[model samples]
Target: MSATDEQNLIEVSGLVSHYGDRQVLNNISLDVRENEILVIMGASGSGKSTFLRHLLGLKAPSAGTVKLLGRDITTMTRRELFDLRKQIGVAFQGGALFSSLSLIENIELPLHEHTVLDKDTIQIMARMKLEMMNLLDHEHLMPSELSGGMLKRAGLARAVIMDPRLLFFDEPSSGLDPVTSAELDELIKQLRVALNMTIVIITHEMQSALNIADRVTVLHHGDQIFTGAVDELHASSDARILNMIHRRPSRHGVDSDYIDQLTR
Candidate 1:
Protein backbone atom coordinates (compact mmCIF):
# COMPACT_ATOMS: atom_id res chain seq x y z
CA MET A 1 0.00 0.00 0.00
CA SER A 2 1.11 3.55 -0.71
CA ALA A 3 1.67 6.08 2.06
CA THR A 4 -1.65 7.64 1.18
CA ASP A 5 -3.24 4.22 1.43
CA GLU A 6 -2.01 4.12 5.01
CA GLN A 7 -3.21 7.63 5.70
CA ASN A 8 -5.29 7.59 8.86
CA LEU A 9 -8.95 8.32 9.30
CA ILE A 10 -8.63 7.66 13.08
CA GLU A 11 -5.58 7.81 15.32
CA VAL A 12 -5.04 7.15 19.02
CA SER A 13 -1.88 8.08 20.86
CA GLY A 14 -0.82 7.16 24.38
CA LEU A 15 -4.40 6.55 25.45
CA VAL A 16 -5.19 5.95 29.10
CA SER A 17 -8.38 5.47 31.07
CA HIS A 18 -9.47 4.53 34.56
CA TYR A 19 -12.46 3.75 36.75
CA GLY A 20 -11.61 5.58 39.95
CA ASP A 21 -7.95 4.66 40.49
CA ARG A 22 -8.09 1.33 38.63
CA GLN A 23 -6.32 1.91 35.32
CA VAL A 24 -7.91 0.32 32.27
CA LEU A 25 -6.19 1.44 29.06
CA ASN A 26 -2.50 2.18 29.20
CA ASN A 27 -0.46 4.04 26.63
CA ILE A 28 -2.46 2.69 23.68
CA SER A 29 -1.80 3.81 20.13
CA LEU A 30 -3.23 2.67 16.82
CA ASP A 31 -4.01 4.00 13.37
CA VAL A 32 -7.12 3.16 11.37
CA ARG A 33 -6.61 3.60 7.66
CA GLU A 34 -9.53 4.97 5.66
CA ASN A 35 -12.02 2.35 4.41
CA GLU A 36 -10.41 -0.46 6.33
CA ILE A 37 -12.22 -3.00 8.52
CA LEU A 38 -10.07 -2.99 11.63
CA VAL A 39 -11.14 -5.51 14.26
CA ILE A 40 -10.28 -4.87 17.87
CA MET A 41 -10.06 -8.13 19.83
CA GLY A 42 -9.26 -8.82 23.43
CA ALA A 43 -10.10 -10.87 26.44
CA SER A 44 -12.80 -9.36 28.65
CA GLY A 45 -11.63 -6.45 30.84
CA SER A 46 -8.78 -5.79 28.44
CA GLY A 47 -10.29 -2.27 28.00
CA LYS A 48 -11.57 -2.71 24.43
CA SER A 49 -14.91 -1.07 25.25
CA THR A 50 -13.21 1.72 27.17
CA PHE A 51 -11.00 2.44 24.17
CA LEU A 52 -14.08 2.42 21.94
CA ARG A 53 -15.80 4.98 24.15
CA HIS A 54 -12.84 7.29 23.66
CA LEU A 55 -12.94 6.82 19.90
CA LEU A 56 -16.64 7.66 19.83
CA GLY A 57 -15.90 10.67 22.06
CA LEU A 58 -18.43 9.39 24.58
CA LYS A 59 -15.70 9.15 27.18
CA ALA A 60 -12.61 11.30 27.27
CA PRO A 61 -9.32 9.52 27.65
CA SER A 62 -7.78 10.16 31.01
CA ALA A 63 -4.49 10.82 29.23
CA GLY A 64 -3.28 11.09 25.62
CA THR A 65 -5.39 11.77 22.56
CA VAL A 66 -7.97 10.42 20.14
CA LYS A 67 -8.03 12.06 16.72
CA LEU A 68 -10.71 11.57 14.12
CA LEU A 69 -10.16 12.69 10.55
CA GLY A 70 -7.02 14.42 11.79
CA ARG A 71 -8.68 16.49 14.55
CA ASP A 72 -8.11 15.78 18.21
CA ILE A 73 -11.64 15.00 19.37
CA THR A 74 -10.76 15.18 23.05
CA THR A 75 -9.93 18.83 22.63
CA MET A 76 -12.57 19.78 20.05
CA THR A 77 -15.28 22.24 21.02
CA ARG A 78 -18.76 20.75 21.48
CA ARG A 79 -19.99 22.31 18.23
CA GLU A 80 -16.98 21.01 16.34
CA LEU A 81 -17.33 17.56 17.83
CA PHE A 82 -21.04 17.41 17.03
CA ASP A 83 -20.26 18.31 13.43
CA LEU A 84 -17.66 15.58 13.29
CA ARG A 85 -20.03 12.97 14.78
CA LYS A 86 -22.49 13.47 11.97
CA GLN A 87 -20.00 11.74 9.69
CA ILE A 88 -19.72 8.67 11.89
CA GLY A 89 -22.14 6.05 13.18
CA VAL A 90 -22.01 3.51 15.98
CA ALA A 91 -23.95 0.22 16.46
CA PHE A 92 -23.63 -0.44 20.14
CA GLN A 93 -23.64 -3.96 21.57
CA GLY A 94 -27.10 -5.58 21.79
CA GLY A 95 -28.26 -3.35 18.95
CA ALA A 96 -29.42 -0.57 21.35
CA LEU A 97 -32.38 0.26 19.12
CA PHE A 98 -35.26 2.10 20.70
CA SER A 99 -37.40 -0.62 22.21
CA SER A 100 -40.56 1.34 21.54
CA LEU A 101 -39.97 2.02 17.85
CA SER A 102 -40.25 -0.02 14.69
CA LEU A 103 -37.18 -0.69 12.58
CA ILE A 104 -38.03 2.08 10.14
CA GLU A 105 -38.50 4.57 12.94
CA ASN A 106 -35.24 3.57 14.55
CA ILE A 107 -33.38 4.12 11.32
CA GLU A 108 -35.12 7.40 10.57
CA LEU A 109 -34.48 8.87 14.02
CA PRO A 110 -30.96 9.94 13.14
CA LEU A 111 -32.00 11.78 10.00
CA HIS A 112 -34.88 13.40 11.84
CA GLU A 113 -32.64 14.48 14.69
CA HIS A 114 -29.59 15.53 12.68
CA THR A 115 -30.78 16.71 9.28
CA VAL A 116 -33.42 19.08 7.94
CA LEU A 117 -34.99 16.47 5.66
CA ASP A 118 -38.76 16.05 5.67
CA LYS A 119 -40.31 12.88 7.07
CA ASP A 120 -41.09 11.40 3.67
CA THR A 121 -37.53 11.86 2.48
CA ILE A 122 -36.17 10.42 5.69
CA GLN A 123 -38.45 7.42 5.37
CA ILE A 124 -37.22 6.79 1.85
CA MET A 125 -33.57 6.98 2.99
CA ALA A 126 -34.22 4.71 5.94
CA ARG A 127 -35.80 2.12 3.65
CA MET A 128 -32.74 2.25 1.44
CA LYS A 129 -30.49 1.54 4.40
CA LEU A 130 -32.72 -1.34 5.51
CA GLU A 131 -32.54 -2.75 2.00
CA MET A 132 -28.76 -2.46 2.02
CA MET A 133 -28.66 -4.51 5.19
CA ASN A 134 -31.06 -7.05 3.62
CA LEU A 135 -33.80 -5.88 5.94
CA LEU A 136 -36.35 -4.20 3.71
CA ASP A 137 -39.24 -6.34 4.84
CA HIS A 138 -38.50 -5.87 8.49
CA GLU A 139 -38.94 -2.10 8.38
CA HIS A 140 -42.19 -2.14 10.31
CA LEU A 141 -41.11 -4.71 12.86
CA MET A 142 -40.51 -3.63 16.43
CA PRO A 143 -37.26 -4.44 18.20
CA SER A 144 -39.08 -6.97 20.40
CA GLU A 145 -40.35 -8.77 17.32
CA LEU A 146 -36.96 -9.48 15.76
CA SER A 147 -34.59 -12.34 16.32
CA GLY A 148 -31.08 -11.71 17.64
CA GLY A 149 -29.55 -11.68 14.19
CA MET A 150 -32.34 -9.52 12.79
CA LEU A 151 -31.91 -7.09 15.65
CA LYS A 152 -28.24 -6.78 14.76
CA ARG A 153 -29.06 -6.23 11.08
CA ALA A 154 -31.61 -3.62 12.03
CA GLY A 155 -29.08 -1.82 14.22
CA LEU A 156 -26.60 -1.96 11.35
CA ALA A 157 -29.24 -0.47 9.08
CA ARG A 158 -29.74 2.37 11.52
CA ALA A 159 -26.02 3.02 11.79
CA VAL A 160 -25.61 3.35 8.02
CA ILE A 161 -28.77 5.39 7.51
CA MET A 162 -26.69 8.53 7.03
CA ASP A 163 -24.14 6.79 4.83
CA PRO A 164 -21.43 7.47 7.36
CA ARG A 165 -17.78 7.36 6.29
CA LEU A 166 -16.85 5.49 9.45
CA LEU A 167 -18.97 2.77 11.13
CA PHE A 168 -18.33 1.37 14.57
CA PHE A 169 -19.82 -1.88 15.82
CA ASP A 170 -19.53 -3.24 19.36
CA GLU A 171 -19.87 -7.02 19.59
CA PRO A 172 -21.76 -7.39 16.33
CA SER A 173 -22.45 -11.08 16.92
CA SER A 174 -23.13 -11.19 20.60
CA GLY A 175 -25.79 -13.68 21.77
CA LEU A 176 -26.05 -15.17 18.28
CA ASP A 177 -25.79 -18.74 17.08
CA PRO A 178 -22.85 -19.74 14.92
CA VAL A 179 -24.82 -19.92 11.69
CA THR A 180 -26.44 -16.57 12.25
CA SER A 181 -23.18 -15.03 13.38
CA ALA A 182 -21.45 -16.26 10.23
CA GLU A 183 -24.22 -14.80 8.10
CA LEU A 184 -23.84 -11.49 9.93
CA ASP A 185 -20.11 -11.63 9.25
CA GLU A 186 -20.77 -12.00 5.55
CA LEU A 187 -23.17 -9.06 5.71
CA ILE A 188 -20.55 -6.88 7.37
CA LYS A 189 -18.05 -7.64 4.61
CA GLN A 190 -20.69 -6.92 1.98
CA LEU A 191 -21.57 -3.58 3.56
CA ARG A 192 -17.95 -2.50 3.59
CA VAL A 193 -17.51 -3.29 -0.08
CA ALA A 194 -20.83 -1.75 -1.11
CA LEU A 195 -20.56 1.33 1.07
CA ASN A 196 -16.75 1.70 1.12
CA MET A 197 -17.08 2.23 4.86
CA THR A 198 -14.26 2.38 7.34
CA ILE A 199 -15.31 -0.11 10.02
CA VAL A 200 -14.05 -0.42 13.57
CA ILE A 201 -15.36 -3.52 15.32
CA ILE A 202 -14.93 -4.50 18.97
CA THR A 203 -15.36 -8.25 19.21
CA HIS A 204 -14.12 -11.30 21.10
CA GLU A 205 -15.36 -13.78 18.50
CA MET A 206 -12.29 -15.42 17.02
CA GLN A 207 -14.28 -16.76 14.10
CA SER A 208 -15.72 -13.34 13.36
CA ALA A 209 -12.28 -11.79 13.59
CA LEU A 210 -10.76 -14.33 11.20
CA ASN A 211 -13.60 -14.09 8.74
CA ILE A 212 -14.04 -10.35 8.20
CA ALA A 213 -11.00 -8.56 9.53
CA ASP A 214 -8.61 -6.88 7.11
CA ARG A 215 -6.46 -6.07 10.11
CA VAL A 216 -6.72 -7.09 13.77
CA THR A 217 -5.50 -5.47 16.94
CA VAL A 218 -5.31 -7.62 20.05
CA LEU A 219 -5.43 -6.02 23.47
CA HIS A 220 -4.29 -7.67 26.66
CA HIS A 221 -4.09 -6.29 30.18
CA GLY A 222 -4.99 -2.81 28.91
CA ASP A 223 -2.24 -2.75 26.29
CA GLN A 224 -1.99 -3.82 22.66
CA ILE A 225 -0.23 -7.13 22.21
CA PHE A 226 -0.61 -7.41 18.44
CA THR A 227 -1.68 -5.22 15.55
CA GLY A 228 -1.36 -6.65 12.05
CA ALA A 229 -3.12 -8.31 9.15
CA VAL A 230 -5.11 -11.49 9.84
CA ASP A 231 -2.45 -13.62 8.20
CA GLU A 232 0.20 -12.07 10.39
CA LEU A 233 -1.96 -12.73 13.44
CA HIS A 234 -2.37 -16.36 12.41
CA ALA A 235 1.33 -16.82 11.70
CA SER A 236 2.57 -15.00 14.76
CA SER A 237 4.62 -16.97 17.22
CA ASP A 238 3.81 -14.73 20.16
CA ALA A 239 2.48 -16.82 23.03
CA ARG A 240 -0.48 -14.60 23.82
CA ILE A 241 -1.47 -14.28 20.17
CA LEU A 242 -1.11 -18.00 19.57
CA ASN A 243 -3.19 -18.90 22.59
CA MET A 244 -5.89 -16.48 21.55
CA ILE A 245 -6.05 -17.77 17.98
CA HIS A 246 -6.23 -21.40 19.00
CA ARG A 247 -8.35 -20.89 22.11
CA ARG A 248 -5.82 -22.97 23.91
CA PRO A 249 -5.95 -23.80 27.58
CA SER A 250 -3.65 -21.91 29.86
CA ARG A 251 -0.70 -23.60 31.57
CA HIS A 252 -3.07 -25.19 34.07
CA GLY A 253 -5.70 -26.12 31.45
CA VAL A 254 -7.90 -23.37 32.80
CA ASP A 255 -7.86 -19.68 32.09
CA SER A 256 -7.51 -17.30 35.00
CA ASP A 257 -10.78 -17.18 36.96
CA TYR A 258 -11.50 -13.61 35.98
CA ILE A 259 -10.76 -14.34 32.34
CA ASP A 260 -12.59 -17.67 32.45
CA GLN A 261 -15.67 -15.93 33.79
CA LEU A 262 -16.54 -14.13 30.58
CA THR A 263 -19.50 -15.90 28.92
CA ARG A 264 -18.54 -14.76 25.43
Candidate 2:
Protein backbone atom coordinates (compact mmCIF):
# COMPACT_ATOMS: atom_id res chain seq x y z
CA MET A 1 0.00 0.00 0.00
CA SER A 2 1.06 3.58 -0.66
CA ALA A 3 1.96 5.95 2.20
CA THR A 4 -1.35 7.76 1.83
CA ASP A 5 -3.24 4.49 1.98
CA GLU A 6 -1.24 3.56 5.08
CA GLN A 7 -2.50 6.76 6.69
CA ASN A 8 -6.18 5.89 6.59
CA LEU A 9 -7.84 3.05 4.76
CA ILE A 10 -11.04 4.05 6.57
CA GLU A 11 -12.03 7.19 8.48
CA VAL A 12 -15.21 7.87 10.42
CA SER A 13 -16.09 11.07 12.31
CA GLY A 14 -18.96 11.96 14.62
CA LEU A 15 -20.82 8.81 13.56
CA VAL A 16 -24.29 8.17 14.89
CA SER A 17 -27.03 5.65 14.19
CA HIS A 18 -30.59 5.31 15.36
CA TYR A 19 -33.47 2.89 14.92
CA GLY A 20 -36.56 5.08 15.12
CA ASP A 21 -36.06 7.10 18.36
CA ARG A 22 -33.67 4.63 19.94
CA GLN A 23 -30.07 5.73 19.46
CA VAL A 24 -27.72 2.82 18.82
CA LEU A 25 -24.40 4.53 18.10
CA ASN A 26 -23.22 7.95 19.14
CA ASN A 27 -20.59 10.35 17.84
CA ILE A 28 -18.00 7.70 17.07
CA SER A 29 -14.82 8.49 15.16
CA LEU A 30 -11.93 6.23 14.36
CA ASP A 31 -9.38 5.60 11.62
CA VAL A 32 -8.29 2.22 10.30
CA ARG A 33 -4.67 2.26 9.22
CA GLU A 34 -3.52 0.27 6.22
CA ASN A 35 -2.43 -3.30 6.99
CA GLU A 36 -3.31 -2.85 10.65
CA ILE A 37 -5.63 -5.21 12.50
CA LEU A 38 -8.15 -3.01 14.32
CA VAL A 39 -10.40 -4.83 16.77
CA ILE A 40 -13.63 -3.04 17.71
CA MET A 41 -14.93 -4.45 20.98
CA GLY A 42 -17.79 -3.75 23.38
CA ALA A 43 -20.53 -5.30 25.46
CA SER A 44 -23.58 -6.91 23.78
CA GLY A 45 -25.52 -3.70 23.16
CA SER A 46 -22.56 -1.38 22.62
CA GLY A 47 -23.20 -0.77 18.89
CA LYS A 48 -20.21 -2.61 17.47
CA SER A 49 -22.21 -4.22 14.65
CA THR A 50 -24.08 -1.01 13.89
CA PHE A 51 -20.79 0.83 13.64
CA LEU A 52 -19.60 -1.72 11.09
CA ARG A 53 -22.75 -1.25 9.01
CA HIS A 54 -21.96 2.45 8.74
CA LEU A 55 -18.35 1.76 7.82
CA LEU A 56 -19.39 -0.68 5.10
CA GLY A 57 -21.91 1.75 3.61
CA LEU A 58 -24.74 -0.66 4.30
CA LYS A 59 -26.50 1.93 6.49
CA ALA A 60 -26.33 5.71 6.48
CA PRO A 61 -24.84 7.41 9.49
CA SER A 62 -27.15 9.85 11.18
CA ALA A 63 -24.58 12.57 11.78
CA GLY A 64 -21.02 11.87 10.69
CA THR A 65 -18.59 11.21 7.90
CA VAL A 66 -17.46 7.83 6.64
CA LYS A 67 -14.62 8.02 4.21
CA LEU A 68 -13.16 5.30 2.06
CA LEU A 69 -9.90 6.36 0.47
CA GLY A 70 -10.78 9.88 1.61
CA ARG A 71 -14.13 10.06 -0.21
CA ASP A 72 -17.10 10.60 2.09
CA ILE A 73 -19.65 7.92 1.28
CA THR A 74 -22.67 9.55 2.90
CA THR A 75 -23.16 11.94 0.00
CA MET A 76 -21.75 9.80 -2.78
CA THR A 77 -23.95 8.74 -5.65
CA ARG A 78 -24.90 5.10 -6.20
CA ARG A 79 -22.22 4.65 -8.87
CA GLU A 80 -19.60 6.22 -6.65
CA LEU A 81 -20.71 4.17 -3.67
CA PHE A 82 -20.55 0.94 -5.67
CA ASP A 83 -17.11 1.84 -7.01
CA LEU A 84 -15.82 2.70 -3.53
CA ARG A 85 -17.29 -0.38 -1.87
CA LYS A 86 -15.56 -2.59 -4.44
CA GLN A 87 -12.33 -2.06 -2.57
CA ILE A 88 -13.72 -3.62 0.60
CA GLY A 89 -14.70 -7.14 1.66
CA VAL A 90 -16.85 -8.41 4.51
CA ALA A 91 -16.95 -11.85 6.20
CA PHE A 92 -20.22 -12.12 8.02
CA GLN A 93 -20.64 -13.56 11.53
CA GLY A 94 -22.17 -16.84 10.37
CA GLY A 95 -20.13 -17.21 7.15
CA ALA A 96 -23.43 -16.64 5.30
CA LEU A 97 -22.47 -19.06 2.54
CA PHE A 98 -25.21 -20.28 0.25
CA SER A 99 -26.54 -23.47 1.71
CA SER A 100 -27.50 -24.95 -1.63
CA LEU A 101 -24.21 -24.29 -3.42
CA SER A 102 -20.88 -26.02 -3.05
CA LEU A 103 -17.98 -24.21 -1.33
CA ILE A 104 -16.28 -23.34 -4.62
CA GLU A 105 -19.53 -21.98 -5.98
CA ASN A 106 -19.93 -19.77 -2.92
CA ILE A 107 -16.41 -18.39 -3.23
CA GLU A 108 -16.81 -17.75 -6.94
CA LEU A 109 -20.13 -16.00 -6.43
CA PRO A 110 -18.52 -12.65 -5.79
CA LEU A 111 -16.22 -12.80 -8.77
CA HIS A 112 -19.07 -13.85 -10.96
CA GLU A 113 -21.23 -11.02 -9.73
CA HIS A 114 -18.65 -8.26 -9.87
CA THR A 115 -16.16 -9.09 -12.58
CA VAL A 116 -16.03 -10.19 -16.20
CA LEU A 117 -13.58 -13.00 -15.60
CA ASP A 118 -14.02 -16.10 -17.76
CA LYS A 119 -15.41 -19.26 -16.22
CA ASP A 120 -12.07 -21.19 -16.36
CA THR A 121 -10.04 -18.39 -14.78
CA ILE A 122 -12.64 -17.79 -12.07
CA GLN A 123 -12.61 -21.46 -11.18
CA ILE A 124 -8.82 -21.41 -10.93
CA MET A 125 -8.88 -18.36 -8.73
CA ALA A 126 -11.54 -19.85 -6.49
CA ARG A 127 -9.53 -23.02 -6.05
CA MET A 128 -6.44 -21.05 -5.16
CA LYS A 129 -8.29 -19.19 -2.42
CA LEU A 130 -9.79 -22.41 -1.06
CA GLU A 131 -6.33 -23.94 -0.97
CA MET A 132 -4.94 -20.87 0.72
CA MET A 133 -7.50 -21.34 3.47
CA ASN A 134 -6.72 -25.09 3.59
CA LEU A 135 -10.11 -25.99 2.26
CA LEU A 136 -9.20 -27.18 -1.21
CA ASP A 137 -10.39 -30.70 -0.64
CA HIS A 138 -13.63 -29.43 0.77
CA GLU A 139 -14.31 -27.11 -2.15
CA HIS A 140 -16.93 -29.50 -3.45
CA LEU A 141 -18.62 -29.78 -0.06
CA MET A 142 -21.73 -27.82 0.74
CA PRO A 143 -21.92 -25.49 3.74
CA SER A 144 -23.92 -28.07 5.66
CA GLU A 145 -21.08 -30.55 5.39
CA LEU A 146 -18.42 -28.29 6.88
CA SER A 147 -17.56 -27.83 10.53
CA GLY A 148 -17.95 -24.44 12.17
CA GLY A 149 -14.26 -23.58 11.78
CA MET A 150 -14.17 -24.82 8.20
CA LEU A 151 -17.23 -22.73 7.40
CA LYS A 152 -15.55 -19.65 8.81
CA ARG A 153 -12.38 -20.33 6.84
CA ALA A 154 -14.40 -20.82 3.67
CA GLY A 155 -16.09 -17.50 4.27
CA LEU A 156 -12.76 -15.80 4.86
CA ALA A 157 -11.34 -17.32 1.70
CA ARG A 158 -14.30 -15.98 -0.24
CA ALA A 159 -13.85 -12.56 1.35
CA VAL A 160 -10.25 -12.29 0.13
CA ILE A 161 -10.78 -13.86 -3.28
CA MET A 162 -11.43 -10.42 -4.71
CA ASP A 163 -8.18 -9.06 -3.24
CA PRO A 164 -9.88 -6.30 -1.31
CA ARG A 165 -7.56 -3.83 0.36
CA LEU A 166 -9.88 -3.56 3.34
CA LEU A 167 -11.34 -6.59 5.14
CA PHE A 168 -14.07 -6.72 7.73
CA PHE A 169 -14.72 -9.67 10.05
CA ASP A 170 -17.67 -10.01 12.42
CA GLU A 171 -17.02 -12.44 15.26
CA PRO A 172 -14.70 -14.82 13.44
CA SER A 173 -14.59 -17.03 16.51
CA SER A 174 -18.27 -17.02 17.38
CA GLY A 175 -19.05 -20.74 17.76
CA LEU A 176 -15.77 -22.59 17.49
CA ASP A 177 -13.71 -24.47 20.03
CA PRO A 178 -10.68 -22.78 21.56
CA VAL A 179 -8.20 -24.66 19.38
CA THR A 180 -10.18 -23.91 16.25
CA SER A 181 -10.49 -20.30 17.23
CA ALA A 182 -6.76 -20.02 17.83
CA GLU A 183 -6.05 -21.53 14.44
CA LEU A 184 -8.39 -19.05 12.78
CA ASP A 185 -6.55 -16.24 14.57
CA GLU A 186 -3.28 -17.52 13.17
CA LEU A 187 -4.80 -17.57 9.67
CA ILE A 188 -5.98 -13.99 10.10
CA LYS A 189 -2.51 -12.84 11.08
CA GLN A 190 -0.97 -14.80 8.23
CA LEU A 191 -3.38 -13.32 5.68
CA ARG A 192 -2.66 -9.82 6.95
CA VAL A 193 1.04 -10.36 6.43
CA ALA A 194 0.70 -12.12 3.13
CA LEU A 195 -1.81 -9.80 1.49
CA ASN A 196 -0.85 -6.61 3.36
CA MET A 197 -4.56 -6.12 3.94
CA THR A 198 -6.04 -3.78 6.53
CA ILE A 199 -8.50 -5.63 8.78
CA VAL A 200 -11.32 -4.33 10.99
CA ILE A 201 -12.83 -6.97 13.28
CA ILE A 202 -15.89 -6.56 15.51
CA THR A 203 -15.83 -9.11 18.27
CA HIS A 204 -16.37 -9.62 22.00
CA GLU A 205 -13.85 -12.45 22.35
CA MET A 206 -11.19 -10.94 24.58
CA GLN A 207 -8.61 -13.60 23.82
CA SER A 208 -9.07 -13.25 20.06
CA ALA A 209 -8.83 -9.47 20.23
CA LEU A 210 -5.76 -9.52 22.46
CA ASN A 211 -4.16 -12.19 20.32
CA ILE A 212 -4.57 -10.52 16.89
CA ALA A 213 -5.27 -6.81 17.25
CA ASP A 214 -2.54 -4.36 16.30
CA ARG A 215 -4.66 -1.94 18.30
CA VAL A 216 -7.85 -2.40 20.28
CA THR A 217 -10.73 0.08 20.52
CA VAL A 218 -13.23 -0.44 23.31
CA LEU A 219 -16.67 1.13 23.23
CA HIS A 220 -19.02 1.73 26.15
CA HIS A 221 -22.45 3.33 25.93
CA GLY A 222 -21.64 4.47 22.36
CA ASP A 223 -18.44 6.24 23.45
CA GLN A 224 -14.86 5.17 22.94
CA ILE A 225 -13.65 4.19 26.38
CA PHE A 226 -10.15 3.16 25.36
CA THR A 227 -7.87 2.80 22.33
CA GLY A 228 -4.35 1.45 22.64
CA ALA A 229 -2.02 -1.48 22.27
CA VAL A 230 -3.02 -4.77 23.85
CA ASP A 231 -0.28 -4.56 26.45
CA GLU A 232 -1.31 -1.06 27.43
CA LEU A 233 -4.89 -2.24 27.82
CA HIS A 234 -3.69 -5.15 29.96
CA ALA A 235 -1.73 -2.81 32.21
CA SER A 236 -4.10 0.12 32.33
CA SER A 237 -5.59 1.27 35.65
CA ASP A 238 -8.82 2.63 34.25
CA ALA A 239 -11.89 1.18 35.94
CA ARG A 240 -13.79 0.46 32.75
CA ILE A 241 -10.81 -1.18 31.16
CA LEU A 242 -10.10 -3.22 34.26
CA ASN A 243 -13.69 -4.27 34.58
CA MET A 244 -13.85 -5.41 30.97
CA ILE A 245 -10.60 -7.30 31.15
CA HIS A 246 -11.48 -9.08 34.38
CA ARG A 247 -15.10 -9.80 33.42
CA ARG A 248 -16.49 -7.95 36.43
CA PRO A 249 -20.22 -7.43 36.86
CA SER A 250 -21.30 -3.96 35.89
CA ARG A 251 -23.38 -1.75 38.23
CA HIS A 252 -26.12 -1.40 35.61
CA GLY A 253 -28.14 -4.17 37.22
CA VAL A 254 -26.42 -4.75 40.55
CA ASP A 255 -27.35 -3.24 43.93
CA SER A 256 -25.21 -0.34 45.22
CA ASP A 257 -23.64 -2.51 47.93
CA TYR A 258 -22.71 -5.20 45.43
CA ILE A 259 -21.24 -2.55 43.14
CA ASP A 260 -19.23 -1.13 46.06
CA GLN A 261 -17.90 -4.54 47.02
CA LEU A 262 -17.03 -5.33 43.42
CA THR A 263 -15.27 -2.00 42.92
CA ARG A 264 -13.48 -2.32 46.20
Q: Model 2 lDDT vs. the true structure?
A: 0.90
The alpha-carbon lDDT assigned to residue 16 of candidate 2 equals: 85
Relative to the true structure, candidate 2 reaches a TM of 0.92
Alpha-carbon lDDT, every model: 0.89, 0.90
| Residue-pair clashes, model 2 | 0
Candidate 2, residues 1-264, lDDT tens digits: the string is: 567645998888889899889898888888888789999998888889888888888898879999887789999998999988778888998899999999999999989999999999999999999989999998899999999899899989989999999999999988999999999999999999998899999999998999999999998877887888898899889887788888887866468887789999
Clashes of each: 0, 0
Clashing pairs in 1: none
- Per-residue lDDT tens digits for candidate 1, residues 19-101, read 89999988999999988999999988889999899999989878999988778999998899999999998988878999989
Q: TM-scores, in order shown?
A: 0.92, 0.92
